[model samples]
Target chain A: MDSIYIHIILLALIIISSIFAVSYARVIRGAIILGIVSMLVSISLFLLSCPLAGIFELSVCSGLITVIFISVISLTLPPDEKQRKVNSVSMMKKMVLLVLLVLVCGFSLYMLDSKNITFVPLMQNVQESIDTRDNIWNLRHVDLIGQALILLTGLFAVVVLFKKDKNKDKK
Target chain B: MSVENILLFKLYIIATPVLFLVGIYAIMTTRNIIATIIGIEIMTKGVTLLLASCGYFNGRPEMAQSFIIIMIVVEVVILTISAGLIFNIVKKHDSLDTRNIRNLKG
Candidate 1:
């Protein structure tokens, strides 16, 4: 119960920071910050008592996504140079969209408030005392093997499909 | 207003979507391909956050957390591969800008 307020504050921080990421002049920096925001969200989940999702968000998401972002594109652009290229119309469009998004999010929160779904105790009335034995949060052997297979296959597919760029001269 | 009872709903229902919106805005507005990928990552995290919140509120943490784990794994593989591909492209062309990419579109 005392925790809800903390979560609320965290939530506010998440939104504000994301807005900063959106508006930042440095796109790569923004992406890096956005990854931090995701980590915050993961933390917020754990605070709310959702450990599984929290771990996922924290371990796999926070760093992995940044690697993806950093990997996919070089982050050497100057902010002002990029800023000069961004037209006012595009910025205005993003602002307008953000406003609408906020409204919808607010409305959904209101709807959740209309219902009384709080105070949920852990494993309230399940026949499955199995909840204790359930290490759903922990990754296991078969899981790792399955994942390894998937990644290996995906790599193979990429190799088979790598086509050389046919046109190196549109600049 | 008991602080504990505050529902913390705004973070999920509000903040989550806002994060997603901002992420989208970043993706759409940025010409830097890496930044755009970051935007996509932000939005994906926003979604996972919302799911975890829902699972928390409903006392079904496993459902949300497991999904998040799976999502994260998939995203990492895809992201790594794509990053390598994008890097390879840039190295061959000397820039990561979209216009340069379009020129290589043949």
Candidate 2:
């Protein structure tokens, strides 16, 4: 019971931080807030008994992603102050409606009766001996290959996109 | 099966969509290209949570963990590519506002 409450609180924090993340005017601040959301998510994952996922979420999403966002933000020119204010004002108006809709949906979901819905029974014969590492390396080797392929593709794409064109420079 | 498990499941089910909505709203409402990416990241986080919770409830935490690890790797690569694109966009337009690049020029 206590743990459920903690989960609820963690989720609430996640939502709130996410809201702040999008609503902030400064892009860097929004990135930082997104990091907070990721951190909360990792905590929730831990509570859900998935420590490996939690650790990955913590390191990758909260740490690496935030760093990526900050570096991108630094590379981009900041918007003019006047335009930022205008954008924020309009965003706030839309955000209010969004919040109201989200609240109603949350309430309805809360009121929903779980007994009416049937969930798959937990697996009774899960192999305890096969750990996550072994599962990834053995059973899910295809996904590993795909990840490696995508990463290589992304690396080449980034290099090409960021490379300066000498002909365009001369022109 | 357990009451705690059911409650946790319900919580995740509710939270996931809300995160999705927030992310979509951010994507649709923001003029900044980077904000769009941020929104996408939020949605990704929601998906991660859903996957983790489902893994826990389905009694396959190891499988879920492996999926998440792969997901994280993919997400980082995607983010890096997008960042590179945004850097180039900023160079071309000199501003982060999407309004400045509304017209696609050949």
Candidate 3:
């Protein structure tokens, strides 16, 4: 028997909504909806015994979503200049591209369906230096902290870069 | 719904890459920066789903869950910073479409 059915449903809901949210999200409200979906999914993961992921997901997805949504939404709300050219070709191109993409994705999904979908649980992507499977909990903390710091630094650099470029544009 | 089967967790590993790839394709082809960020999020989310499923399959939760947590952090940060930059670019250049931003035509 499965450990939790409702969580699975919630995850499924999150995944499906995420895909739709991506496709249909034109404005800020739609994006917020998708971000909300991510938050709910994170909560579900926590309920399934993954508190670490749950906490970050809530922080990123929920914590930043409201402000980000409002800001992004407000940024493009009213065009100050009537510089919009209204290109019709771009819309047609996007529609055609979307159809082709759907076809390809459908075919790929079909192909994967016929095969044995489950892998051998060989832990393919995991780094193998930590050989002991049973005792990984205590071991990963140090590495996680280091990688996390590096990641934070990288994010800071990116923001500074963006700020620099925007200032350059102003000049 | 078929994911309810006992073997579905196992299958999630295979499905994960496809989801990630498709999401990337969406991101690359779409010109909208927001859509692109959403695409990147999808790809990362697929990886998390894959890792979580793998852990569930093998009955190991610690490592996978931890990575998922890290990914969530990075995703949020990247999404905000990039989105903010794109918004700034759009405002300054007067175009939400990214293709038109290249003013250096050398």
Which of 2 and 3 is ahead in TM-score? 2
lDDT of 3 at B47: 79
Q: DockQ for each candidate?
A: 0.42, 0.67, 0.36
Off by over 4 Å in 3: A1-8, A76-92, A117-120, A124-138, A141-149, A152-155, A158-171, B1-5, B10-22, B25-29, B102-106
Please write out the lDDT profile of model 1 over residues B1-106, one tens digit for every residue. 2434334654366567767777777766666666666677778777877777676666565655655666677677777666665666566655555545665344
| Residue B69's lDDT in candidate 2 | 84
Residue A14, model 3: lDDT of 68
Colliding residue pairs in candidate 2: none
lDDT of 3 by residue, B1-106 (tens): 2445445653454456656765766675565566666677667767776666665555556666766766666666676677667767676766666566647666
Docking class of 1: acceptable
Instruction: Mark the 10 consecutive residues where model 1 chain A has the least summed lDDT.
Output: A128-137
Is candidate 1 or 3 superior in TM-score?
3
Candidate 3: residue A70 lDDT (0-100): 58
Tens digits of per-residue lDDT for model 3, A68-166: 765776776433333323411256666776687778767877776677564435655555434333333466656567667867776786667555556
**Two-chain complex of model 1, DockQ on C-alpha atoms against the true structure:** 0.42
Evaluate model 3: give its lDDT: 0.62
